[model samples]
Target: MADKSNKFDEKLPFEAAIDKAGYGLYSYIMTALAGVAIISFVCIVFASTIIVPTSACELGTTGSQQGLLAAGPVVGSLLGGILWGYQADNRGRRKMLLVSLCGGTIFNLVASISVNWIMLMIFQFIAALFASGLYSMSMSLLSESVPMAKRNLVVLLVSSIFLLSQGIMAALAIPIIPLPFSFHLPALGIYWNSWRTLLVVYSSPSIITIIWLYFMQESPKFMLVKGHEEEALKILRVIHRINHFRSKEEFEVLGLQQEAGQEAALTSSVKEQVAPLFKMPLLKYTIIMTALFVINQVGAFLVWLPTIADQFVRIMQTGENSDLNMCQIINTESPVDDSVTPCSLNETSLLIVLGVGAMQSIFNFIISIVVNQVGRRNIVMMVTALCGVSGILVNLIPSALGSAVVFGVLTLGVVVVGLYTAITVSLFPTQLRALAIALAMTGGRIGSFASIQILNLMLVNSCDAGFYLFSSLFAASAIVASFLPDDRRGKVAALAKEETHKNELAIKTGND
Candidate 1:
């Protein structure tokens, strides 16, 4: 259909043509759309952080059970990350994303109506199984779709969608949870309160996201690599036409084209595609990225920061113990009062939690704006170092501001994840990109799983030691970040070019 522009693809690869198409309204629109999907997924993961404990009172959940509720989504992600990653690489990112987001939202609604704790847990697990795919696949689609020059800041901002969701959740929860409303269904023997209502309120965006993706095209570069040259060029023109409305008449790319001899390797068996990530320098890249993710996830300051907001305030107000540590302040029991009704809010505690989330979200947006100038590696190192110092000060200085610094530093982990995602997306070919990210991010998942267990063991019995452990890990990760090449300026794109060239050569030689 893109007859006039088909020759553009023949003469110049889709990747290069896309670079020529450059950043425009269409690119930003897709960025916003993809960011929304990420927001939905992150909302599901974290919304439970608030909803679980709130429901625990009526649900008769023990502290351990509450922990499980918080971790349920992570467990689901651990199980599905690799599977979804592999699917996106083989099946098409847009298709996998639709399946993930739509499917997750339906089950999240089911979870809201869950009659029992086990039922809710099971529902959440199922929801995460689908939702988890969106995070990894969204990165693939956005990084590949956007131009190289804009990707670092773009991916950083997009990855920060989770932080943004936290802020939104906090802002929305205040009014919604305070509504003082409840809905009960006798047939199902269920009673719903403001907390449960919050789930549907927050998660409803996934429906909008699904509808958006329904009209959105797959990554044009992705289509080109898989032999859908016509479709790819068509998408490129649509993009150009959107961004270049006044000059639409001048849009004359002929069609999608691979480099010379690239057409032969358009198709690949799953194994042929997956095998490369495990071999060569790609393996090294995957390992380092995974480690960084692990550190970020293990020390998920943002998640635990809210839990400790009240505690941090308490310590700061009293200045009681010079020896007190972060885990002592943060990793504590549930805020539930058995004397009160289930799923009910403790006004002060709830507000504090919400406020912390809102503040963190705002900080994330500020970081995204500044990261373009500061450079990602510097941000990672600077934050990790500050986190370590905050860990020490939280122990030594028992001040309110000290606790705030720790909270703010924890937020940096989100930035590191964003930077890693942006860089890694550039380093791999499209065929293996999803799986590669999934595998790398799986490190963070595993780290989260371990961190929870470790914190549980150490936070209460040995606070100072726990504080040192987390802070030291961040310190170590900072050193690691120092070694990671800063690819904010076309480094990933350069790697992608080489990989594309490699893919073309393999296809031309019939090696696949």
Candidate 2:
């Protein structure tokens, strides 16, 4: 048979073939593209946090309305997460990402021209509905494309970009939102101001991501698992050629092995794609990861960090020397008029946000460097527990500077997001990986939406309670993270075990 002829040369396991592909420029480019995808998704979701405040005068947004606007992306992403995950597993990661990015960008552009806060919220929700695919799928594509050795570091680095995006938005806002230019549109009955202009600028990453991803290859692992071995081999050859700067013919990976127990036929139904994650071996990881996501994503402290910073600055501006805990400082009546007027962001608050983002990004990068050595499980436990302690400390800190520092530490929960993602990639099988992440993210989005809404109420009535609640959540997360399987070696052993099980089943079937 032609298959026998194809096997004339030595073949490699999937990981071996990935190693043979070599690490080089192509790998760096894939990592960069994945980072851009993170920037796009993070900016799109959080853009309203900045825009709602800056545009308060023009949009006539109340505090409650602003909270709802902030929740829109979470709600939309929550709704779309499972659907996008199902499609990504079924349809292919690259193709679905292109569709989602293009669609999200178009809707995001439409959001810029909105006449009112409600319209803006609606459009942003729709945009997030499309953009939701980027969350898990981007990680899926990047993890599958790169060699396994670089996988954890590269993924964490990209997650650092997610943290950096807040600063990116702040840096972008520093120049753009303060621009003293406005144009009135008589027909639409709204003023075209810097905030609206900023939304347009925010959409640029998705545009750039779409263009880059269009030229890139589908995850070869996905291809291989789906029984397109020839196509997968071709991609590996291209990777080898580009990585080594050598001819494709010199790449001697003549064949690739299917992952142990990989389903050759694509699962056509949503149930088929999702069911595996809830059964037997994968179920425990799903439960733990989802719980961790829910706990970490209770974003009350983080969502309100900027507002607290701005409030702290305002309080200090009044020459009040009395040291106060977070609740006291935030709840203290400021001497200045708090009314929405001609829009402006405090330079100090902007700096605080930028600083927090910068610190987190650097920390994430450092984690990327040492993660392979320290191990993902150990890192997750330490960082998450640190976040819990910080959250508790944030409420106790009386000094403005101290509170800001602790808030930065509290926000370290963002780092855990990346670790959980890396864990999920290693924990789940290729066929179910995207869907499993999507399901976990669905839990996270719900947590975010609930946390934001709950915090809105708590920050008004009981600020300390909100901090205590989130700290408790983080404490719980750290406890759960301790149980994770050693990701690196576990993945290899799991594959070999599955292969042995399959062989035994075949032998038993043959005896019958």
Q: Best TM-score goes to which candidate?
A: 2
Cα lDDT of model 2 overall?
0.80
Clashes of each: 8, 0
Backbone clash pairs for candidate 2 read none
TM-score of 2: 0.92
Candidate 2, residues 134-220, lDDT tens digits: the string is 979999999988887788878998899988888888878777876768898998887788888999999999999999998888988
Off by over 4 Å in 1: 1-10, 259-266, 310-375, 486-512
lDDT of 1 by residue, 404-509 (tens): 5664555445556776786677666666678889988777887886676566556567766766777778768888877766644445446456755664454344
Question: Best by lDDT, which number?
Answer: 2
| Cα deviation of 461, candidate 2, in Å | 1.2
